[model samples]
Target: MVEHSGGHVVPFTLVASAAQAGQRTDRFLADAIGTASRSRVKALMQAGSVRRNGTVLRDAADPVRPGQCYSVEFPPAVAARPQGEAIALSILHEDDSLIVLDKPPGLVVHPAPGNQAGTLVNALIGHCGDDLPGIGGERRPGIVHRLDKDTSGLMVVAKTEAALAALSADFAARRIERSYLGLCWGMLTPAAGAIEGAIGRDPRDRKRMAVVARGGKPALTHYRTLEILHGAVSLVACRLATGRTHQIRVHLSHQGHPLLGDPVYLRRVPGPARLLDDATRRAALDFPRQALHAQSLGFTHPATGAFIRFSSEPPADFHALKAQITANSGSA
Candidate 1:
């Protein structure tokens, strides 16, 4: 491996130690690089940026042999405080301490590669003016938690350092309450149950998350079937006891009922039409993204010492799909 110097992110040259040898490329990079996470390494690999002895590495699972030299190129990190964009925000509640947003689909929570501008953070920076810079670091501003780019939901943004610290503690302590609505591919036995699993990067596909029996962080999802769509699909309400990346998706997919329209965790139903009605089938097949939405959020106010709660309904596409599902099911 080539020797270089600097604490900042730059091209990295690393060798596979005996312990790292035979480890997956993504896993090895995550541990050896010290700065990148496994998911970030996977993104680098998927972007065709990681190379082994000058050869581009295509597979995240490519095993690194002992003494193998690999070079990885990472773009210089963007300076904090990306220019603010005047994107409209859906405000649920706002106060001096914090602001709650009913986040809409397609709005990224933060700036990242391929989405360096026009993120929720950018919008907040514009809306909050100078106050945001002091709330969180320059990079994330007020972000306390995040919803996926396509998952519409309620999310709280801190406006002050004190609020940020308090809200962060509440989230870590599991004092924040959150619930989601999702349509899945199949019925869950017992209609209501708790799914306890550990979520980690999928060994087979580092780009996705999975329920690993070991080595993953504990995640629990309590779900109740809200509506049954002809025994083929079910609408469910999910409450998370622990927040993890893609926790609900991984847990549901582990049990063989992946979320409908979820590109990453989809498990197509094997039987006849999961949706009997023609329109419903068409809508389900053409669904744009996962049918999951954060419908409820509750937490104690950091400044007021009062409990606050907020809720949002599914978006238009979600409603359309639900209507089609009901119409197709008839009475069943």
Candidate 2:
């Protein structure tokens, strides 16, 4: 959702009052007019969006002491040429505290590098308005967890402070369960297994994440083969025991079965497995991104303490890819 136009992101100011006492700068701004997420606020600050008495401010946790005047400005929506397209959203369930959405592939969970506008965050701002709390900062107001840009499926957005706090804690403690469906390069022989590794920045390529021994965080993924694919590929279901950056991708690739269109990890596909009909291969070779989906999300509601689960079918592209593979060789 990153808008590249020479658009103007507007700025606004807030005068501290008694009602806003003890609130952090990020939270106050999120609840203010235009309803931005905490992550958005962080982006604004990172993009030099906030100023305290004409001085640029950076940290979200910076105390909004009483009687201080703060100025915040966002790139105006209009200037970014942002059009509110009526995108259909699949709502699994809803309540005062949270929402579970079946996010589509290519829709980023929240704004980040190369994506700023037209994101789930911006759409939430348009839909939820002032309901989202300031947790992760302006750009990420209600987001408790994230799905990669090309991944599709269920994700939760918090609408209140209590929900935000509770959901955050659940994720931090690994109490919330998330599952995904992925198409990998080849059949996984054992069909059921666990991937345990430490992931960190690739010293050779900073843009990619790799299984590293040093300076990496522990990541665990448990996966089972849901179905065999054309004697070569496999449909796999994965569950996270520890959520780290690209945990599932790293784990699956480490097992020698990179996702079908995963550019970063599985760069070299063996000859026979490249199902593209020469011409189609040339076209698909230029396909923009990878294939991954966030198909399931489950957690205990922070406010109600009820176990909730949501699932979404893979998007059209995912189906199309599978269909192509099926045409190459009958289903397994």
Candidate 3:
């Protein structure tokens, strides 16, 4: 008998026989499950979906014992390919090899567990039709990079395999130019400097990123303050030296000046909030999402080998937020 666990949508128990004893856990499970491959069983084991008795089993090479009961849980399958949607896109440039666009706030980049439709990928498929070549896989065709759902900015999508390979290589080599505009709480000291840290998932909170001393990838951000509004918020321009998930947000927050309206990092009302008037403070506090935008992107054209760059002003909401904050200072 095996100990009971919860939250498994599809689960089945398999008992090891004397003949199967001493065999590798993953191999035995793969043979018993029949439908799942050895690699798939290993993946499931790694994901903590495989359990022996009551404890989660992760090591695929662990030897099985006779009469031991193993429980395997299978997650629900998702659509093989995302359906195209007729969502509008702000196209900046288009060519045979690539398409550059200004992504607005709240547009997800790819289809995921919670977001299976109405994404930028679906819109691209509709707009490009048969011209959109599958870059990495069927799931996120031609997607070389991504912007967060709430971060508005310029993005480049590869249209062909060659372009995808080249652009991906360029991004990996840090040859691609990327810059962002972020409004953060408080007047950042020195006004211009670089922030360097290694970023990884926060151990305390898996859903958020944090600067960790170990098991983290190196990240760097160079920034200069463009404006200081009412001594409370500062509009800053940031250039990326290395791309990492939430690199700018994590780095800036680690520096004690998280971006304004960042739901994940800005957990409380900043001390600088007192600098603003009542209405301005309320408006700034009520701002919905992070005040960060990918303002510019530059990279060499994969087909033509020509360097091209594109830039966009911050969206109207960003402008309005800044204006509201700066109104007291007569700098709107």
Q: List the candidate 1 regions with Cα displacement exceeding 4 Å.
A: 1-79, 267-272, 329-332
> How many clashes (backbone N, Cα, C below 3 Å) per candidate?
0, 30, 0
The clash tally of candidate 2 reads: 30
Candidate 3 worst ten-residue window by lDDT: 1-10
> Over the stretch 1-332, how does candidate 2's per-residue lDDT look in tens digits?
22334664445777788788778888877777456798888788888878887889898888776777788775645423222334567778878888898887778766665676678877776666644525456668888888887777888988887888899999999998898888876777688988989999988999989899899999999999988755566788999999898888888888788887777887875443664455334333444556678888889989888897877888888887766655553221
Residue lDDT tens for model 1, 1-332 = 22335755557888787877788899888888887899989988888889898888969998887888888887655656766778999998998999998988889998887888889998998898977876778778888998999999899999999999999999999999999999887789889999998899999999999988788999999999999978767899999999999888889889888877888887554443544666667677668888899999999999989998999999988888877887785322
Candidate 1 collision pairs? none
Pitting candidate 1 against candidate 3, the one with the higher TM-score is 3
lDDT of 3 by residue, 130-239 (tens): 55636677888999888989999999999889999999999999999999999999877889999988999999999999999999999999999999887789999999
Q: Scored by Cα lDDT, where does model 3 land?
A: 0.90
TM of each candidate vs. truth: 0.76, 0.71, 0.77
- Whole-model Cα lDDT per candidate? 0.86, 0.76, 0.90
- Of the two candidates 1 and 2, the one with more favorable TM-score, higher being better, is 1
Could you tell me how far off, in angstroms, the CA of residue 64 lies in candidate 1 after the best superposition? 25
